[model samples]
Target chain A: MTDQALGKPEADRPAKGPLIYRQAVLTRITHWVWAIALFFMLLSGLQIWNAHPALYVGQQSGFEFDNAILRIGAENTPEGPRGFTTVFGQKFDTTGVLGMSELRGTTNFVGFPGWATIPSFRDLATGRVVHFFFAWILVGALGIWAISSLLNGHLWRDVILKPRDFRELPRDIWDHARLKFHHGRSYSPLQKFAYFGVFFVLFPLIILTGLAMSPTMDAGWPWLIDLFGGRQTARTIHFLVMVLLVLFFVIHIAMVLLAGPINELRSMITGYYRTSPGTDASLPLEGRERGRGRSGGRREIPTPDSSPQGGGEQAGANRQEKSK
Target chain B: MSGLILNRRRLIGLGAASAGSLVLAGCDQFDFLGQRNDPVRDFLERANSLTYAAQRALVGQQALAREFSESEIRQGQRPNGSTDPRQNVAEYRTLEANGFAGYKLRITGLVETPKEYSLAELQNMPSRTQITRHDCVEGWSCIAKWTGVPLGRLLDEAKVKPGAKFIVYHCYDVMGGGLSKPEPYYESSDLIDAYHPQTIAAYGLNGGALPVENGAPIRIRIERALGYKQPKYVHTIEVADGFSQYGLGQGGYWEDHGYDWYGGI
Candidate 1:
């Protein structure tokens, strides 16, 4: 929603009405690089966590203290050492997946199973190595992406939500809830919000919290530790961010499959997205899907000049000429 | 801007899918990543240097780690690594048997005077007691009080040689020797950290004599580093220009075993 959108420089964007070059080559490359880097970082991070397998809050944590908010470990049971995961003092038997797990028939005590970690064995040194390396790569990729996205106008026109997007938020939510995804020239209001949240909030939070956990960073920038409460709290927040990221990952994949897997994959892989027939490349996201049996129930997204009044079907036949 | 996170998410999703298929997917096949002569391993290891250089450049050597007040010492320092070197080394056993009265810390290598100080001599020297957090590399933090003479003070008395680049802390605990003889655990600190004010050769914990399991007679505490870098049961402090003569030439026992020598993180 800036001068870039007003200019509409993409003259040949609408190829046969549906196919369009949506994602840029740089975005595609960065996306795949990030994917690979994250694959290594998350697993190696799990391997690193296997070293301690416990998380706490506040400034201090040790044998004499019981302030841990989350702990994935095993304890001596009547039969043998059984695995359990505790969250906020509530324990759950997470045998086989967490804590006690079998590695070639010999069950070992680990935070995450071998299949979930880098090296697939206990090696904190190697884990840290892989984790840190990929971490730098991720940071570098993010830096490059930030610059390229800004230069390409994707940050402002595609990702950033405007006042109109906020007004249309309910429709986007309803569309997502009912699997009524609209393949548009630009992202839906929900897509913009989600992407913006990931780009600005989660990524930065995770990275900062990660750095705050480092003793060197703590020494250099004490305010970072203070920002996150403490090193332990920073660590806990880091873990939570990882969890949220994973949730986002699963949901994103599910959405891709539900909306149109082949089209979405092509868009990501080849930077060419096949937009819906109703999607007009000339117009921005304002009223692209004007009246194509859309807006099943209540229409919350008002057109550029007027409120959209419609129904489940045959409600916008009279407004077709008015929209044109 | 969303590409990396999406990229990561897709990669993780694919990894999870492969994991469901029971194929050694994602990170499982990354065994080649850490092997010697492997390009992947070499590349990964290089990142360690990058991290080290970046951290040093950013934090510098003079920045002080956060020091907690007396009230912040909520618990005793967690005993880790080779808690009691006496269990393995007979020399340490003898020192422990005699209340460490016969123990002597030998400071050798590239220094003006290769001096030896008894436990009492080290205790009587100018000391600093500060409450600090010990951040274990395994991702845990424990705060406790530690009292010992500043390592800079000891290095000053010995008059560090010009070419000395590192201070090696040789401990009594034997962590690994592979197929060779029993090699005692050791760690090294660069001169920048070596001369830091908070780097102490500690002998007291929680206002009491340091427990045997807590490195007993002496432990080297680099305040801004991880717990593993703080070598316990330290009996020798060697000033050296390089690590070519030490275990596998990496600088310390853990470093020899693939741990990064720089433990600031």
Candidate 2:
């Protein structure tokens, strides 16, 4: 039944012509779950950060050591109350958003504004609760996704960069900068790089650093703290990783919009991506090629066959046949 | 796809169970669900408890908080929260006037022998001096050398009763005053932390008598926990089986207002 539904020829479905199985059912489901989990994690994390708006290096930081790398707070100036963010001894006035913000005419001294936090208030307990809850979810989802993707070859075929990707990096960046995205089944080099960085490096670092900051975790794995150069340094790295993730989100959204949000959203939601008719001919058997070349960059591009039908089935067949 | 769905369902179920357990445990005042009573908050409260339990289990009863070297001792430890007791408190003022000569630390509750020790007596006792870092929940840390009697020694001397599960510190500072009823700042710790080698009733800081602003005559240092767990200006140490009747029954003043009682991190 699954095969019949997904394996139908493109000729029989002209209305949604030249559809590519860009996202598998598992991929689509995991994608949405990740979206929800990350949303909660980000907001709640901000809420937790508000409790102590300073980031530092080394194991210990306080009035004694000049180890503070970043600090957000409000101070009384000669003019008036001002919110400031200090990084490496340089202070920047960030009033009304960070360090200090006003809600209903009452000024509040906080790290991030209430609007950006999970509970939208200065409740440290609640903030921690929310942050930790989503943290579990995020970790679980990532673990499952990683295992499944590894087994299915999705990690290497789609996310991990190949030698060819390095060669295509310049072109992919230029194309993306110009908003000239190629509507293909395989990820662009830039997309592969971004996703790979987030999935492999940033997320893992965040999780490990987070654990390092926990006192209990320190007891369980003292090496974790030592690896990060201390709990405070781990915290600083965690905050930086969060900043990188936020940047990834912005770029991801922008790319989705530029490349066509309706198509991108539909692909992720329904597992069917409507490929550009012009690019379809040039990028024929792209999915099948990915399936065959598990090591990536080793397959030759086949000429476009007249029949667009059974591309999805052909890709699956190629995966099985190659393995055999 | 079905497996993914199952995973999500399992996650949601786990979240729900966590929330449900907190509600069932009847720690409503401490749980987010009892305060705001929302599904999200409920889930978060459960998660916090899971963290608390998991960390406790992993670290075990004897794990020590990281200690630093004397070179790591930064400037004098910064004073935060309520540093000074209210001037109107007569006994506190008198104690301050006589250089804490009249000050006495009383140990009562769940003990075979209740004992009161003066500053001089506490000082004369075998002392452990270590340079340790104080990590505040607000995201800052300070290192200072502290000299005091180990709490375990004091507890042994006082002969803690077997049923005692928690050590509650009654402090002299009164906070949240002005328009409302003033409440004394108090905190408590489990026996595991109370008995830790680093846990001390410190009377000296940075080679000098502890400054009044830095908990003055005495403060409790449970090195592994956050700064708030180290209650300053301690007037009495009470060993109790439970803290159900203390400060809205959540264990500490901050705990009553939503902070976790087991603030090990």
Candidate 3:
């Protein structure tokens, strides 16, 4: 089908090229689902963190031992209620946001601001409910995504770093540092690395460490605590991983906007992506042709109107065929 | 790089605009989205119940919380929440002065024999010593050696009634002293937790007589649960069908104020 027939916007229409189907239908759906799940999880996780704004090492830690690596607390000073965050003995005044914040005109002492929490109140019950609800969704989505990605060889063909990726790494980093994003069918080495690191390493580690911290999970899998050194250590690791994930999210969004948010968002939303006109030669033609071949039953263009019924299974099949 | 900077500025501008609009729309709207009776909360409740059930299924009722070695024990168990008993209560003051000699642990409600035991009687019972970690919901942990009579033995001796589903620990410590009213600190556990082998009415901590700060002359130790569940200054054990009669009807003091009743973690 012609680019004009697809009814893409003028900005999305390249001067001399067609729109490539970048993200599969499954990818788009799961991406949005994950986005929602992670949003709730992050907020609720922050709420849970407020209950005890400290992270420690080893099997056990308490007031007796000075083993707390991180602590967010508010103290009643002569001046006023002062909020402080201590990280490895270095204390910082984080009164307005971290340890204490003004919520609806009330100066409330909480680890994170009310705006950053799920319930936006000092309610551990509500926080836990929200957290566990999204946690299950996140875990289920991740499990399904992982299994399907493996079955389709997307894990190997797309995200996994190839030997060629190593050679392209420095150039990709240099280009990204300069904000010179190349429009192509395949992800940049940097993008691949970040996505791979988050999906494979960070996500799994966070989940495992989270389980390690669960008392019930300890009964079922005692080795989890031992593997992570201790429950407290697992909690520390979980907190660190959460921080890293937040960092990744910030950078990811920045990159998306830098490259062109509308185009990037549209690709993940509708599976159609517009690349620079003359960059078709640089596109991964073999993968594209393979996708087209496997997606033979449907030829409907993924315009805004027709995207929802675009058939995720067919798109998944096409991606799988491409991987093969 | 200039193009990048311009784009970044535009992104920031867009974000600021959206955020400003959201704030202008009123923060209460956000709260309304997460209102107590919202369908989201119902969904979350279902999820929590599912987790509770699944965890129960995965880990058998008898599975014990991990125990530690003596070397692993920290400097001492840290006293949390309300450490001291209410001084205004003359009985507590008199008991404290006499080293808890007058302290009597009463076992009532849903038992064949309503019994009361003094500190000496409790200490004379067959005891078990365990070096276990006390994980607080506040994210810190401590290891201490707890020596006490197994709660199962006590329950057997008292002969728990068939309908009894929970054991409520009535404590002497009263939080937030005021002329109007003071709240007694209390905790409860299901029968499974109550009868667990590690559940004990501890009279000794770290190989010494339990300190006043650590709930002398006794505290209940349910090793599988959080520190709050192992309430300090325990004065009475009431066997009940449920804990609805307790503070706020949520089973415990902390539980009343939004903490989970099933504090397995």
What do the candidate models score in CA lDDT, each in turn?
0.80, 0.76, 0.77
The number of the candidate with the highest TM-score is 1
Better of 2 and 3 by lDDT: 3
Q: In candidate 2 chain B, what residue range of length 10 has the lowest lDDT sum?
A: B25-34
The C-alpha stretches of model 3 lying farther than 4 A from their native spots are A1-17, A73-83, A93-111, A118-121, A151-153, A276-324, B1-43, B88-91, B175-183
TM-score of each: 0.86, 0.80, 0.82
In angstroms, give how far residue B28 of model 2 lies from its true place.
24
| Candidate 2 pairs with clashing backbones | A61-B141, A64-B75
Off by over 4 Å in 2: A1-26, A62-65, A74-79, A107-109, A275-324, B1-39
Model 1 chain A weakest 10-residue run by lDDT? A306-315
Each candidate's root-mean-square deviation in Å? 8.9, 8.1, 6.5
Q: Between 1 and 3, whose lDDT is larger?
A: 1
Residue A313 lDDT (model 3): 26
Residue A229 local lDDT, model 3: 96
lDDT of 1 by residue, B1-265 (tens): 2354356447656755764564344455777655655777767889889999999999968998998888888877888777767667898899899999899998899999988999999999889998888999989999989999999988888999899998999888997556777777889989989889899999999999999889989999898889889988998999998887987888888788788889777
- Candidate 2's TM-score reads 0.80
List DockQ, one per candidate, in order. Answer: 0.43, 0.29, 0.34
